[model samples]
Target: MSENIIDTGKLVEEQSDYLLSFAMSKLQDLELAKDLVQDTFVSAITKLDSFENRSNIRTWLTSILNRKIIDHWRKAETRYTDPVSSFFDQEGKARHWLVEKKNSTSVETVVDQITREEATMELYNCIEKLPPKWRGVIASKYLEEKVSDDICKEMEITPSNLWVIIHRAKLLLRDCLGKAEFQ
Candidate 1:
């Protein structure tokens, strides 16, 4: 039993970096991702007796992490929600206090705002599904707005490898996002 415990610790430690990247891609919050991964390991250790060995340890831990992510999203959605009409008057014109305080600024239509938000959320979900290295390259290039040279340097890949990874990642994202709307 002690030997099994040692093996479990080694296996979980090996998978920690991948789990951290997975959480980070899902949450987009480094600290939150770290916390989630820590929580995942703790849960695994506590439930060690029930593991049954049917799946790899990583898959088991990922399922737990995903549940936590879903719970967090649910809590966040409820916490900040306001009535749809709260920011708009009867005419659907913007009447929010912050909008009124701005000078010479254009107000975005609510429909467009909601659509953009949905697309952004779907994009993040697709990104999270990508392989860790490919996701890192995509995030560095697009989210961080890094140049090719910089990305190549930071990722320790050759320029050609970087180009190949970017191209493949884009194709994967395109396929994923194209199917997202149907879901």
Candidate 2:
């Protein structure tokens, strides 16, 4: 029984970097990754007795960290919800805060502004579902607005490969967004 027990301090020392890197890959936020790792340790230690020792300590810790990450994303999806009233007037006209006073802006522009925040959030959530390499590729191409040549050089992929990756990522995002709309 004693031999089966994990040494908390030693496990932390051995696995901290690996866990942190794993969290960083999934979350892309340094501070949040650190917080999740700490939370993982706390939860694991608190429930140490329940650990069956069937798997190694690192795998156990990783499972706990993954759960924490899922919970964080779930909470974030509902956080900072925009009030529908804020976008509409009492007469039911859409608010024009996002547009300039110039009349040249079209109705599509206003509608886009109204739905932009929600769509952006949904797109980000979909991006999170992508594989780590694809996530980085999508971020560089779209979010960072990197040129194709530069992205190819940076990611060490050919131009054709870059387009293929982008196509796949976009397809995944479209599927995710479609499903999110129903939910």
Candidate 3:
């Protein structure tokens, strides 16, 4: 048991950086990648007794890391998009009018009314109001700047699903922004 613990500790220490780098490549955020890697190791360590020896230890650890990365994506993706309230609302037409109205507002009035901090907080609150699925896709693709392929892989979605999610998310965001501006 002592030897097993030592081996596991040594393995984690040796592989943590590589695991973290891999996760970072997938996640594009240093802090979240680090957390995912750390969580992976912790989970692996806790489940060490279940090691069935059917596969290489490194493979087992990597599988755990992959799952961690996916979970992180799932959680992070939900923050950037909103749920589709009405799919047939003709977002493009509505958006053009909204932009016109917003732009017609005096620049000084806009600036005076919303400080940077307030704008950011309001934006965050709007994001929080989005439906869980739309939020995830938007967060992963737009906010995190992840490629579609990467986002799809992380979210286990197809290209069609990705496009649909993005379209709905954009509509939701536009609605949210419109509400914020009017408020």
lDDT of each: 0.78, 0.79, 0.70
Alpha-carbon runs more than 4 Å astray in model 1: 1-8, 83-183
Cα lDDT tens digits for candidate 3, 106-175: 8887676556534554455566567887778778876899998999998889999999887887687768
Q: Write the per-residue lDDT of candidate 2 for residues 70-170, one digit (tens) a residue.
A: 99987886786556766788898997957745557789987776477456655765687799888989989888999989889999999899989989988
**Ranking of predictions according to TM-score:** 1, 2, 3
Instruction: List the candidate 2 regions with Cα displacement exceeding 4 Å.
Output: 1-5, 82-183
Clashing pairs in 2: none
Question: Against the true structure, whose lDDT is highest?
Answer: 2
Question: Least accurate stretch of 10 residues (summed lDDT) in model 3?
Answer: 85-94
lDDT of 1 by residue, 1-183 (tens): 563464755766677877786676567889999888889888888887777787766667878887888888988887897656678888988887686767644556655765665566567767878999999999998899999999988989999999899889889988988886411
lDDT of 3: 0.70
Task: Score residue 178 of candidate 3 by CA lDDT.
Answer: 69
